[model samples]
Structure formats: structure tokens, C-alpha cells
Target: MKAAAIFGPGDVRVMDIEKPEPGPGELLVEVKACGLCSSELGMWVDPNFKTDDPIFFGHEVSGNVVAAGAGVSKFAVGDRVTIFTDRGGYAEFVTVPEDWAIKLADHVPYDWALGEPIGCAMNGTSRSGIEVGDTVVLIGIGFMGGLIQQGARLKGASRIIAVDTRPESFELAQKLGADHVIDAREGNAIQRILELTGGEGADVVIEATGKQGALDMATEAVRIRGRLVIFGYHQGGKRTIDVQAWNWKGLDVINAHERDPQAYLKGIRTGMKLLEAGQLDIAPLLSHYFELKDINHAFLLAKSKPDGFLKAVITF
Candidate 1:
């Protein structure tokens, strides 16, 4: 089996490795597609980042079950699924616990069935507590953010305001059901969100850029008692927040990242159901695709984020 092993920053090599077999209560999936997540970009670009082992990486995966280990009765050898595995997805095969794998409808393509990030978006939406007719502001309309925008609309948000620096993002956000868009480069995103919310801030503000500026804007663009959902994958270093302002505003701040495997599994199940029902479409967000041999190139493109790029997937 061929697999990608990162030796250091900017150094990814494809090497022949032994394919892993499923353990008890696990399913061995033949890799069909895996997404290149921004969260792992540090491993490819940050020179200071170090890893004890590099064999198991790339988590967003969708494939066909090739073998079912003992006690795995929920799925069979021929089942198609989007799996959650902390193993090497950038390979010919990977094994996941049966509980972490969700069925993929026949209609959903393998490349677009990026279960992990889709689950993340769904979990974030659930934590947002978006009530019907609530004004929702989403800062940073990237891949996950765009999905969240769609989820927000389905959650019955009265008005969806999208904030991003890219013009393409504004267009996509509108297409995804955002009622208004703000250019973050204009230096008045907070004010614009306030204006759109009728002098009061939005009912719920979500920061999805994973940047300090977007986080600051989200904090300021929420109403006194509104919920602020941090849905972004913040990396690199620590961030500073205005604690005094949060204390005074009586805001409900929620970090929307899920650590518990059960929570992630639940979100994946819900997201897959939504995808099967045609309630969510991720076709447009998959902007780039690469073969497993070109994993390094895929990482470079994801890190640089060339024009028209949203998300990159490595296909078997």
C-alpha cells in the first residue's frame, strides 16, 4: 500500500507501507477520498512544528468498507461510509471503529463526502442555539463557514450576514442564503454588522476565520446578551480577548470545537442524514483535487490558497 509520510515542513513523500488491518469492533476502509484540512497545514508549513511520528494523518475520509472486524455488525464488507479515524487516511486503506463510521448514501459522491468537517459545521450550528427569526452574523465564509451559513438558514435565521475579505466568498455566501455581506477589508465589519442588525448587534455572532481580527469583530458584533460561537480552528499562538467587555455584555461565549469522539460521531450522523436528504450540498466547496502521489502539491496549494480555492481533497 502507498501512503504519505511527512518528514518535515514542506517535505512529504509517498512510500510503500503495510496496510493496516481492522481490530475488534473496527472496519477496514479502502481509501477513496480524503480532504486536506487547514488544521493540519501547520505540519506542512510551520518549521517549528515537530512530530514524533508522521505515518497517521489526514482525517477527513470517505470510502468503501473492505473488511469488518469482530463485533462490527452495524456495517458489512461492501458498505460505503464516511469515517472518523485518527489514522493515515492519505493511504490505500485505514481502519476506524464501527461506531465512528456513518453510512453514505449512494447518491453522495466519495469526494464530496468529507464527513469530519461537515460534522464540525453541524456541531457548531447545534451549539450556536440559533432560534427562528434570529439575526446571525458569520465572520469568514470559508468551506466550513459556508456550510454553517447553509445550516443557519435551515435553522430559520431571519437574516444571515456574511463577513469576509474575498469577493468570491460574498457571492458564495449570498448563494448559500446570506441576506447581507460585509467586506472585512473595509475596516468597519463591526459597524456594518451593527447597522444590519438595526443598531443592536446580531442575535448570534460566529467567528470562523480563526484569525484575531475576525474574533475581535465577532465579539463586538454580538448583542449584549447574544451568543458568540467560535467555530474557527485557531492555531499558531495564543489570542487575546477583551474579558472586561465580555463580562459587561453578559455574552454567552461558546467554543464550538468538539473533542469527544461521541459528540463527533453524533454530528457526523446528523450531517450525513442532512446530506442524504439533499438539505446540504458541498459540491461547490471542493475546489481542488489531487492524487495521493501529489499530496505535497495539494498541501502547497491549500496553504497558499490560490484564487477560486475553497477546499482540497486527495483522491485515491
Candidate 2:
């Protein structure tokens, strides 16, 4: 079997490894597509964050079940499935806990079945407290950012403001239902967001960039007493927040990352429902594809995020 591993910083290699068998209460999946996550960038390049063990880092994945271990009756062989696991997804095969594998409908595309990432964004949107007619601002319109914008709109936000440094994402943001797309390159994102909201800032501001600058901008762009959802995977470092500003505004800060199994399972189910209903479109958001053998290059492309590169999937 072949799999990708990060032996150390700046090193991603496709190498032969033993095929894993499903343990009791698990399933052995033949991976079809695995989505590259932004968090992998820091884990792949930063020495401080490097791990001593070889890391197979992809988490957003979809595949077909080849076999199910004892006690796994919820899914059967040949079922199309997506999984969220600790590791082992960037490979030709992976072992998923039966509970972690969400069976997909026959019509679900392998790439669109990348429900783990969608579930993540759904968790953040749920935390954002966006209401009908509420003004919502999303910072950093990357893949997750873009999807969350659509989620906000679906949740009935009247005004959706999308922010990002990449001009390439503006059009997609608008297409995703952002009424206003602010180019952060202009250096007055906060002021402009304030202006767009008639000086009150947004009712809900989601910090999705994972950058310190975007976090600071989100703090300033959120209205007093409004909910501030932190959705970014803030790489590997310390980011100081403006405690004074937050105190003055009396903001409701929510760190929105779901780790519990039940939470993840519930979110994944909801994400699948939204995708089936055409409420959340994963098509426009998937902009690049690569093969498993080119996993290293794929990681580079994901890190660079060249124009039109919102998300990259390693297709098996």
C-alpha cells in the first residue's frame, strides 16, 4: 500500500506502508478523495510544530468501504462513505471507526462528500448566532470561509460581508451570497465594514483567516455585545487579542471547534442534509485536484493557494 507521510518539517513523502485492517467496531476504506486542510500547512513547514512520528495529516476524506470489522453493522462493504479520523487518510486505504464513517448516498460526488470540512464550518456557523436580518461579517474567505458565508445566508442573515486578502476569492464570495466583499489589501477593512453597517459593526463577525491580523480586524468589525466566532485553525503560535477592545464592547467570544464524537457526527449529518438539499454548494469551492503520487506538490499548491485555488483534493 502507498501513503503520504510528513517525516519532518518541509518534508512530505509518498511511501509504501502496510495496509491497515479494520479493528473491531471499524471499517477499512479505500480512499477516493482527501481534501487538504490549511492546518496541514503549518504542520508541514514549521519546525516548532513538527512531530517526531511520521504524520499522515489529511482529515477531510471520502471513500468506499471495502470491509467492516466485528460489531460494525451500520455500514457494509461497497458503501460510499466519508470519515473524520485522527490520521491515516492520505493513503490508498484507511481504517475508520464504524461510528466515524458516514455513509453517503450513491449520487454524492467523492469530492463533495468531503463532509468533515463542511461539518467544521457548520460548527462555526452554529456558534456565530446569525439570525434573520442580522448583519454578518466573515474574515478570510478561503474554502471554509466561503462555505460559512453560504451557511450564514442560509441561516437568514440579511447582510453578509466577506473579507479576505486574496482578490481571487471576491467573486466566489459574492456568488456564495456575500452582499459585500471587502479587499483587505486596502488596509481599512475595519473602517469599511463599519461604514457598510452604518457605524455599528456587524451583528456577527466570524474570524476564519486564522491570522492574527484577521482576528484583530474581526474584533473591531463586530458590534458591541455581538457574537464573535473564532473559526480559524490559527497555525502554530501565540496571537494576542485586544482584550481592552473586547472588554469595551462586551463581546460574546466563542471558540468554535467541535471535538466530541457526537458533535462531529451530528454536524456531518447536518452537512450532508444541506448538501443534498442544494443549500450548501461544494462545487464552486473545489477548485483544484491532484493525484496521490503528487501529494507533495499538492501540499505546496494548498500552501500557496494561487489564484482560483481554494481547496485541493488528492484523488486516489
Residues 59-147 of candidate 1 have per-residue lDDT tens digits of 99999999999999899989999999888788899999998899899998999788899999999999999999999999999899989
Candidate 2 residues 1-316, lDDT tens each? Answer: 9998887666888888899989999999999999988877877777666565777768888999999999998999999998887766899999988888888887779899887889888877887888999999988888898889888988889988898877778988977878888899999899999899899999999998888998889889999999899999876669999999999999999998988877987888888888877788899989899998888888788877787889999998
Give TM per candidate: 0.97, 0.95
Error of 1 at 72 (Å): 2.3
RMSD per candidate (Å) reads 1.3, 1.6
Q: Where does the lowest 10-residue lDDT sum fall in candidate 1? A: 48-57
CA lDDT of 88 in candidate 1? 75
Error of 1 at 243 (Å): 1.5
The CA lDDT at 84 in model 2 is 86
